[model samples]
Target: MTTFADLNLHERLTRALGELEITTPTPVQASAIPEALAGHDLRVVARTGSGKTAAFMLPMLHQLLQHSRPRTDTRALILLPTRELAQQTLKQVEALGRYTFIKAELVTGGEDFKVQAAKMRKNPEILIGTPGRLIEHLEAGNLRLQDLEMLVLDESDRMLDMGFSDDVLRLAAECRAERQTLLFSATSGGNAMEKMVASTLREPKSLMLDSVRDLNESVVQQVITADDVKHKERLVQWLLANETYDKAVVFTNTREQADRMGGVLVASNLKVFVLHGEKDQKDRKLAMDRLKAGAVKVLVATDVAARGIHVDGLDLVINFDMPRSGDEYVHRIGRTGRVGGAGTAISLIAAHEWNLMAGIQRYLRQNFEYRLIEALKGNFLGPKNLKSNGKAAGSKKKKMKKKEDAKKGKKPARKKPVAKKNSRTNKPAVPDTNSGFATVKKRKNPGSID
Candidate 1:
């Protein structure tokens, strides 16, 4: 029965929320807002679309309003892993601060650096950007955080995955030592993540709103086995034709795959847009805009480009290629089933990729239902053998090696390379007379061209 009123949000922010019809706080918002508003550093582990964005923003905005200073540098900073996320978060910030004089600006990559620098020079009250781009600005003396009051690392786990951990740590160190830090991630565990949290947050109040297993409870997760990439494409075509959906996002692992799948889907006469790291900023924005407007029914994207995509009426997510990790799987499917809406996530798994899927299932500690298409029943049914614990059986060769090594009471030494036997006799073979050396000796004797 708690509401935004109970959170003691700034009057202007409360009015803004009321105008937007955001009266009640989500579980995450309710749990973290009070602590965050109290100036305590926090680490929030919540599912995507669980209102994590507002949970951090509302409190940060509330705190920023108290001191209300117009300066040349940012008082608060929010670092996301991708440019798209930064842009999206900026939109939310603008909407929430509509009534307040607080100004927030984005400084992500893919846009003109000089232009962003120009904006930064104006000294907005808040700055949101990806780590690498922010570092670029920092090195160029365009952005500074020495007097920053608050720092929020949205999608912190993704930053590590994208290899921006060092840059993030550096940014945090450059910020004011007394600033409040908030780190939010869909994942909360991992050595690297743990190290970053320990260094960045000082005794943070950790909030675990949902576990990985329950992240997609609202989405029906299913698997469609495919023979290969081509087979998967056909299955995609079939699903789009037969399944019910408002909009669909097809996820691939690489930019090339995203482009290729987009091409395939386009050739089939389906309105599709391609999005990935290699795409130009304008094109990326265009693709998203088209998809959001329902001008395009499908969006093929790599994980990098899809981070910031949250389209209303998007009820289906298809994994063209199984993600490499459990965390990735959670994120890919998370594109749907957002904000308590019902959706479906389908993954295309080939025969060779069965073990990879099994590992993800074991990692998430949840099993996916196997669904078959009557017309396109692929050769891959499922993993042939499974262990007693329901996991895919280990490799036979690996199991044998382990058993043998255990019996020997020591590990076996690596086998040395065997020397190859010479097929020819030990004596050198006679040289060919036509090898251009037949008359070379006579000519060379006199050192003349005879």
Candidate 2:
């Protein structure tokens, strides 16, 4: 029953939380705040919407408040995988530091470099940015980290996935050797991730709040089989019309699909907004604003917006197209069932995508309930075949077996024989290794053998 008040946070931070109506500490904050405040590096594995941002932000802010020093350089640096996430984190930092003298700023892509560099010149106590843009500033001599006391790598897994490992590691190496490093990731284990953690964090305190399965328990996940793209569009329209929801987001794998779904939903008289990487920052920000303002009930987006976008009162998440990975599925659904909220995640699964869906379910150690609306049932019932363990059947194993059999049945390739010249010189000449010619050395007799 420990609250944010009991965490010994800065008085200003407590007041800010009170104004924000955030009284209770999330499990991650409860577990990690004390150690973080104690000046220990931490590696936290928790799901999205778990208040992990507050966990690290509060402790770092508290440390900054307790040890006030002239702002010579950035004292705390937080690196996020995406620009949106960095901006969101910067907002959190600014809000919590409102009553204090602490200065927080953001540096992300899609902005003028000179403007960002000018902001850097202000020597903010806390600097939050994406890796690529931050690297640009570092190379441009606009930012320095020699005075940095804390380094945070938020969404480490996503950063690695986006090929930012080299930049992140390089930044970490450039910082003060004794600086505290905190790595927050959703995935708990992987070889590459292990290496990153070992290189970045010291003997850090580890906090793993919940695995993917445990995180999904609070959300109701279901699948609706679609006959094809058309059928999926119909299902999406039907669900939006029939389902009860405060706000909903439909996830697509590609920007094209996101746009198409947005059009379809709009055509059906539903308020919609589209968000993805291709959209300009202005458009992306406006989309989020519209969604949050309740001006739009449906937000169609790609996976690029999955982790960064957080919406309050979002009770339904529709996977217009199924996610490719279990972690992505978890994150997409996580946008809704936040902080003990009751949420629903419905996936539109085409016939060809059943195997992919099955793999995700198997990875998460859970099965999605198959629900069909009676009036709009599609031709695809389900996967016609299933594995022994009841997962959707796939032809991959059979294809591999067939390939092996074909290779075994075929004859081995023939090896060419090495030719030798007849001593009598009757056969076509073959050159000797040492001698340039046949080395026949026209014998004393034309036909004489050597």
Candidate 3:
């Protein structure tokens, strides 16, 4: 029978929360908010979408309201791992503090620095930003954190996971030593993250949640043996075509891949949205927003898209390629099965990725339940025939390697890199693209007969 009011939050803030229909605090919010409000340097480990944002934000808001009015100089600082996350946190802060008079500014890349500098003239009571952009302002003397008393590192492990330790340290150096430091992350086991926290937080209290959010147990993790890149594409196509999935988000490792996948998905006559780093802010927003609005169901994205993406009713997450870390695996699949929802995560595992998948399994403490999607299986696409431009797998273009190596005295590499087979090895021999993708069709001879 406990609620936000029982947590000793200010009536005004509680009223604001009530208006948003947030009467009951989540486990994270209930535990983290009161501790944070006491200005204890605390570390919180909780899953995404656990109302952890408000756990820190409410206290930050109340402290800002109680201490001073919105000014032209910055006072409180929040560092988020990704720009999308920073924006999402800002949205929550803005919504909750609508009644309270507080000016908050967000600083991140892919935006006009001049415009942000202009806003800095108004001196915000709180500034939320990604580490890189925040560091830029701090270096340029545009971001003054001398007056900052409260600092929240939302998704701390992710900040380190994204290689932001230096930026975080630089930003911390700008703030007062006595300032409050609150760290929140889904994964708190990283030593580097801990070192960063050691220097920033003051006698921090650690609150860890019991469970990590994961896709439903019913929706098993399956890995398909993709011998080559093209086979993976075919597999994706077959899976998408056959599966009666309601909505799916496919994650690739890079921006180019996302764009390429977007085209392929669109050609398959599926509504697709691609989110990546190269996309302009507007385009990226439009992609995710449209996906959320149900205008697009298949979302093709990079790791940039995976972090902090909250889409309701997402049915499937395809790891067209997996990220190189266990933490990444957690965040990527955490996109699905959110808020007690059931969803599936499928990874298209190639030979080159076996080591990575092993590490991910070790991190999650569970091997991916191997399942051969029988209906969606396909052979690999390789440089099988004649072509000048076969791209190289190890060195240069696989097609070029296949072609040039054939014509001259140069010896060719082994057809398939050998690996020891483990359990679930009974599937048909997967195909590998030997030469290149350009010539999938049978080639007519350029007849200088051998």
Candidate 4:
């Protein structure tokens, strides 16, 4: 319920936020900005849409404005894990800090390094970049951090999950060790991620806001079984068949899957876009621009590309594939059902994937309330040609029916039970990796992601 004005943000930054009609600070911003303003190193755990960016951004911008450092040298650095998110964060900094001389240069992958270098020569007060390119610039002597005072890792967990931990570690080492490092991630649990945070950050002032990591009760979860990609594609087409949402994102595990699903959705006559690492940064930005303009209604992306994609009022998120782990699932579905709007997360599971799906369900400790969606089911590979006599088919069908009846005989067949989740790290489904099944679950938060 606190307003941005109550946070004691600078008048200029507050005006800029006001121009965007952002009046109140999200929990992350409200809780974190003051601590950051006081110059404490931080390891913050908050959800994707919790406005943590502003938590750090407002304070970092204040530092630039307060210090009024020369434009020929950088004063602060923000190392993000992805180009899109770095770009997104950089834009916010630039927009909010426009009234001041605090320039923010986007140092990321896929763009011309020469252009980034030229911007660097201008020595902006803040540098926002993905680890690799920033490191590239650093190695080429295009960047220096001798006077750097602030460093932020937005989505730090993903930096580790995607194998960028070494890059980030290296960059952090290069910066002044005395500088404040603000680490923001969705998970700071007992997992490997939490360890990374502990190992990197100092006795930082940490605010453990797990609201976003919980099952945003606002984002409904409806699980479905799809035999294959075709049916899942059908499910998406059917879901969008009516086009109720202004925008939605379908998540796949691989870039190929994202590209294929995007094409299929477009062919099904939906306005769509695909975003992933394989595409150049320009393409990714184009896709995002289109989505923001509502030129594209469906965005298909992999987990890497989807992180930190901030779109307001995104009504739905589809897991074209269930995440390999619960933390990933929590972050992926978080794209929607944000900021108090109603949202839905639909995960399509294959029968063989039941092992994984079951692990996920057991993690949530809730058998998903599955709707058969029979009308939308695809003829998965046109149904495998039967290689049996009619009598054989009849016998198998009869036998299966009897087994189902027997299963039903155990008790009145009941609906999947829903558990109140505390957090992703609270409970886990026993995993068998040799069988390729392991899952962790978080209790459903009736409110939001932590």
Q: What order do candidates take by TM-score, descending?
A: 2, 1, 4, 3
In model 2, which residue pairs have backbone atoms overlapping below 3 Å? Answer: none
The sequence of per-residue lDDT tens digits that candidate 3 reaches over residues 87-115 is: 77788888998887787898888889999
Show where candidate 2 strays beyond 4 Å: 393-450
lDDT of 4 by residue, 328-373 (tens): 7878877887766788888887755555665665565554666677
Query: Over the stretch 1-450, how does candidate 1's per-residue lDDT look in tens digits?
Result: 389998777899999999999988888889989989888999989988788999999988888888767654689999998877887899899999999988889888889999999988888889999999899998999888987999999999889988999999999999999999999988876899899998899988889887766675779999998998989999999999999999999999988888899989889999999989888888988988898889998999998855687888899999999999888898888888888889999999997778888888888888888899999997878767888655567688987888988998986678999767776765687788877566555443655575
Please give the CA lDDT of all the candidate structures: 0.88, 0.87, 0.78, 0.78
Clashing residue pairs found in predicted model 1: 72-123
- What's the TM-score of each model vs. the native? 0.86, 0.87, 0.78, 0.80
Model 1, global lDDT:
0.88
Worst 10 residues of 4 by lDDT: 385-394
User: What is the clash count of model 2?
Assistant: 0
Q: Count the backbone clashes (under 3 Å) in each candidate.
A: 1, 0, 21, 13
